[model samples]
Target: MGNHDELICAFLLSGDKPGRELSWQEVQDWTPDQGNIWVHFDCTHPGTGDWLRAESSIAPYVLEGLLADETRPRCDSYDEGALIILRGVNLNPDARPEDMVSIRVWADSSRVITTRLRRLMAVDDIRNQMPTGKGPATPGQFLAKLAGRLIDRMGPVIDTLSDQTSELEEALIGSEEESNLEDMRHKLNELRRVAIALRRYISPQKEALRRLNHLDEDWMEEEVQGPMLEVVDRITRINEELEEIRERASVIQDELANRLAQRMGGTMYLLTLVATIIMPLSFVTGLLGINVGGIPGSENPWAFAIVCAMMAAVGIGMFMLFKKMKWLTIPK
Candidate 1:
C-alpha cells in the first residue's frame, strides 16, 4: 500500500478465497460488477478521509459515519446498504479494556468497507483467516464473523473482572488485616469501574448487533441469520455477566465497610470502658492528696496505707461492676 492509500488491507473475494490485495488505484477503479470486495482502512490516516470523501461511492451519511470522531453502536439503512458503528474492548498495548475502540462499516450486497482509529484484534483475526482461504464468503457472513470476533475477545476480559471480584470477596471474608482490606477495596473499585465502562459500550453494541441481525439486507439472507443471531446472543450473555460482576463487587464493598464499622465500634467500647474504670480512681487519689491542714491522711503513716488500699479496692469494684454489666464484652 502507498502512503496515500490508507487501506490496511483490501480483499477481492472470489467466493471467500481471497485474491491479490487491492491498491488505492485498484480500489478506486473497482465497482460492484467486479464481485465482492472488503476494504479495511485506518481512519486516522490522512489519506483515508480524502479517498473516502472523493472516491468511494457511498452515501453522504455513511461517509460522515466512516469519518466520525466519536460514535456509539448503531445501524442505519440506506437503499440496500447498511451503515453500522460498533465498539469493541480495547486490546491495544498499554490500553485499558474498558477504553473500547470503534469500528464503522458500510456494507452492501457486493462491498464491505470498515474503518477504525485504533487497531482491533478481531479485525486482524479475520484478516489473517483470509490467507488460509477460510473466511466469510459474503458481506453478511463477514459482518456476522466480525461481530463474533469482537464479542469473543470480551470473554477473557470479562472473566478476569469476575475472577478478581471473587478473589476480593474471599479476601474480605477471610482476612481482617487493615492493609489487606485496603488492597481488596482498591481492586474491587477498579473492577467495578472496568465492568461499568465495558457495559457502557457493550450494551449499545449488543443492541446494534441485534438490529443488524434483523436488518432487511438482500446480502444477509436466511443462511446468515443464524450466525448473526448467535452473535447477538453472545453479546447479551456478556452484558449479563458484566452486570453480575458489578453487583458482586458492590456487595463485597458493602460487606467490607460493615466489617470495618463493627471493628471500630468494638474498639471504641473498649477504650470507653478503660476510661470509666480510671475516672473514680483519679478522683479518689486527688481528694486524698490535698495538703490542707485538715486533710484526712496528712498526719498518720497508717492513714496513707489505708488510703492506698481503699483506692485499689475502689478500682477493683468498678472493674467488677463493669464486668457484671457486660460492658467489656463489646457489642457486635
Candidate 2:
C-alpha cells in the first residue's frame, strides 16, 4: 500500500442484489434508489455513515495484479465486521526472499470484498475453489474458508521442513567433518528463519480468530466459527513444533563447535611433542659434525654407528617418558 501502483477492489454481493460486481468508481456515483444492494470495492478512504462500508489502508488499485513482495499474515475485526490479512508462501524452497504476497479481506452480511497490494497464491486458490452459482453467503463464512485453506496449505510446507531437519540430524551424527558441518549449519539456520517467519506472521491472525469466536455477531455462525477455530489450533501447534526444531538446531551447532575445538587442541599437542623430540637430535648431529677439534666419537671409524645408537637410545627414552605421562596412545 505504501507505494503501490495499481489498485483494484471488487465486491460480490448477495444473490438478491441486481449487479454481481460493483467497482469503487461506480459506487462513488451510485445512488441507492437504483434498487441494488450496494457492495463497494476500492473504497479505501475513511468512511462516513454509509449503510455498509469496507475500507483499506492499502491503495485501492494495488489489489488486482501480480505481487512482487511478501507480507506477514494477520487478521483484524472492525466495529461492523472482520479483516483477514494473509501472506502467500514462496514454494521455491531454495530461494530466500523477504517480500511476500499479501491479501486483505473485509466482509459483512450482504457483501464480501478482498483487497491486496499484490497477487497471492492463497488468494487465487480460494477464488478458484469457489463453486459456480455459490459465492460466499456472508463475509464471516468467506473469511473462515480462506483461513482454513491457508492453514491447510502450510501442512505440506511444515512437513518438508521437519523432514529436512531430520535429515540434517542424521548427517550430523554420521559425519562431523568441516564441510558437512558447515552445510548442515547453513540449512538449519535457513529452516529456523522460515519457522520464525511463519510464527511471526500467523500468530496475530490466530489471536484475531480467537477474538472473533467470542463476538456476538450474527454473521459468525457455526460454519464460520468451527473452521476458524480449527485453523487457529493448527497454527498454534505448528508454531510450537517450529520452536522445538530451532532448539535442536541450536544444540547441534553448539555440540559441533565443541567437538571441532577439542580435535584441534589434540592435533596441536601431538605436533608439539614431535617437535620437542627432534630438537635434541638436530643439536647432537650438528655438533658432532664439526671437524676442527675434540668431538667425542668423531675420530672413531664406527663413530657414525655410535651416533646412530646414541640417537636411538635417546629417542626410545623420551618415547617411554612420554608414554608414562599418557601422551602417546598405542592402538588396541
Candidate 3:
C-alpha cells in the first residue's frame, strides 16, 4: 500500500519464465545486467524517498515530478528513460469516479520504476498478468497495456453518464410532475460536473500518449509503437465521448428549466384569473358592510339570498368570459 513503509512490489522479468518477486535486499542488489526489473513503490513511504534519493540517481527535476503531491498527465524524456504521469478514474470503495488517481513512471529499456500514492486497478492488472507469463515483456509494452486498461475501465463510466442523460431526457418528455422535473435538474447538473472533471485529466492524457507514441526512442520501437497507437486512439475517443455527454447534459438541463418555468407560469396565471373573477364579487359583498340607512334592501329578509344568487351568476359569467378570451387556458 502507498501508505506503508514497504516497497509495493519488485519483479525481475525473464521473457520466457514467469516474473519473480524480489525482496527489498534483492531489489537493492539487482542491476540491469542481471535481468530487467520492475520496481513499484509507494511514493508516500519515507524509506522509498530515501532510497530514490541515494540509490536511484534520477535527475533532480524528474525526481521532483515523481514525488510531487499533484501532477497532470505528461511525458518528459530524460537521458535514456522517460518520466510518464498518467491519471485513471478513482474506482476505490466510497470514492467518486471523477476524482482521478495518478501514477508516475520512469521507464527505460531494461529497468522500469513506478510510484503512486494511490493504487490503480490497471497496475494490478499488469501484476496479475505477469505471474502467468502473459503480461508485457518490455517497459514500452507495459505502459501501453496499463494505458489500455485505464481506458477500458473508463468506457463503462462514460456510458453510464450518457445513459443517465438519455433517461432524464425521456423522463422530461413524459413527466408531468413538477417534483420529478426538479430532481432531474439536480441530476443533470451533477452529471455535467462529473463529465467536466473526467475530461480535465483525459484531454491532457491523450496528448501525453500521442507524444509518447511519436517520441524517437529505442524502447518505443516498432512493436511498442503499434500498441501505443491503439492506446492513443482509445483515449481520443474517450475524450470525444465525454465532450458529447457534457453537451447532451447541458441541452437536457436547459429543456428542463424551460419546462419548469412554463409550468410555474401557467399555475400563477390560473391563480391570477381566479383572483380577478372574485374581486368584483368581493366588492359587491363589501358594499353591504358599508354603514348607512336604507342600504339597498338591507331591511328585507330576501336581500341576502338575492345577493348570494347575484354573486354566483357574476362569478360564472366572468369565468366563461375568461375561457372565451383564452385567459383561463395555458399553452402546451
lDDT of each: 0.86, 0.59, 0.86
Where is model 3 more than 4 Å wrong at Cα? 1-4, 291-294
Over the stretch 1-332, how does candidate 1's per-residue lDDT look in tens digits? 66755789998865447555688778878888887889999999888888788777777767889998988999888895999999888999999989999999999999899999999999999888887777887888889889989988989998888888888877777897778877887887788888888888998898899899999878997898998888898889999999899888879888889877888898899889888888988888787667677887577889978977888898899889878987779866
Please give, for residues 186-302, the per-residue lDDT of candidate 2 as tens digits: 887787787777667656656766675665667777777777778778878866776777787787778777767767777887788898888899999888777777777766899
Candidate 2, RMSD to the unseen true structure: 6.5
Clashes of 3: 0
Best by TM-score: 3
Best-first order by TM-score? 3, 1, 2
After TM-score superposition, the amount by which residue 271's alpha carbon in candidate 3 deviates from its true location, in angstroms, is 0.8
TM-score winner between 1 and 3, please give it.
3
lDDT of 1 at 310: 85
Model 3, 165-274: lDDT tens per residue?
Answer: 88988988899888898888888889888999999999999999998888777877689788888899988988998888888887888888788889888888878888
Model 2 spans > 4 angstroms off: 1-74, 92-100, 131-135, 176-178, 282-309, 330-332
Better of 2 and 3 by TM-score: 3
Among residues 3 or more apart in sequence or in different chains, the pairs in candidate 1 whose N, CA or C atoms overlap within 3 Å are: none
Q: What is the lDDT, from 0 to 100, of the residue 203 in candidate 1? A: 89
RMSD values, in order shown: 2.3, 6.5, 2.4
